[model samples]
Target: MKKCISFLTVCLLMAKLTTAQIIPSFEFGVKGGMNLSRFSHTATFATENRAGYLGGIYARAGGLGFNFQPELYITSKSVTVNSGSTQNKATFTSIDLPLLLGTKIGAFGVGGRFYTGPLVSFAINKDQNVGDALGNALHLNYKDQNLAWTFGAGLDLKKVSIDFRYEYGLTKQPYNNGNDETRINLFNLTLGYRLFSL
Candidate 1:
């Protein structure tokens, strides 16, 4: 675990330095938004959209023709179960770092982002004892660390930007039901600003 973290840190620093040397245009920004996520299991189960938050600092380099952007941020995500009007929620927090390859054509810009080389997380809290939500005690088991995948696109304007991305869960939801893996897939749309380097 220590080795992995160290390696990732080195890689990120190298990428930043390399991008600075090769590209001329650079922008730093802050972004925040909601994540609409759904949890799906092999059998029928209930799930709901829980409120989530994401904030990060990003560096955009290179010129109008082609560019590379990378962001480091922390995100909050959760999945809820609702049955017959009763609901239960499980929330997890993670730190994510993503790198994007982007291009421009006319007024519209498009890009593909590769997210999740590593994620560190911990369980903040959960609701299992709420009656009717489960009617009885429910057992949950999960690990604190996970690796996830995110793929998506965005629209870039001169002063503002809008981004859309989808995240997929790769680790099994730590639970005793071996066949059941907590599946969460979310689409994120964010509003951002170019805080530095116009």
Candidate 2:
């Protein structure tokens, strides 16, 4: 009985050591996707699906089956409204920062990412029916980054990876329409590539 107990203890220790020896593979990649969005309070207006794109470098570090990935990129979002013969549109160009937490099961993977930790925008430009059309050198305010979240799944095929993520905004656009507050909610599908092998 004593010998059996000693053998079991050694086996347990070996398992722990094996787990500790596992290391994560780090890689770089790019991501792009589509955006479908609308104001939360503006139900009278139909939601618009726009072609939003995000392409930038990303670094992933992880061990076992968990990874933390952060990325920087440019994002374009827009909303359109049609009231009979008139058409109205709102477009926003902002730099986006996404921090993703990824998990792997065998060769398949899943992730949850949240963007909006912090950002500085120059507004770049704005086109509104109620305001002036093009003489505006609108600068984006740097008060805070827009809050957003995303969920997606992908496959880590050796050194290459492709992912699809949906992003949703959690704050207003700092502009008000009379008694109505304009908020940002985007549904995005992003595809990314891993550059370096881990």
Task: Tell me the spans in candidate 2 whose CA falls farther than 4 Å from its real position.
Answer: 1-21, 41-44, 83-85, 108-142, 174-179
lDDT of each model, Cα atoms only? 0.60, 0.57
RMSD of 2: 7.9
| Predicted candidate 2 versus true structure: per-residue lDDT over 1-198, tens digit per residue | 999999998888767544532565667776666666665556555545555555556777767756777766666777775545666676777666567776655422333333223222223344332122111212333344466666666655555556655566655674325444466766656566665654
After aligning candidate 1 to the native by TM-score, how far in Å is the CA of 139 from where it should be? 34
Please, what are the lDDT tens digits per residue for candidate 1 over residues 1-198? 999999998888767655544456778998877787777554546777777887766777766356677665666787786656667676655555555665543322323333222222323334422231112112212334455566666666766778788777666564323445676667777878888774
Name the best candidate (by TM-score).
Answer: 2
Candidate 1: stretches off by over 4 Å = 1-23, 82-86, 107-144, 175-180
- List per-candidate RMSD values in Å: 14.4, 7.9
Evaluate residue 167 in candidate 1 and report its C-alpha lDDT on the 0 to 100 scale. Answer: 74
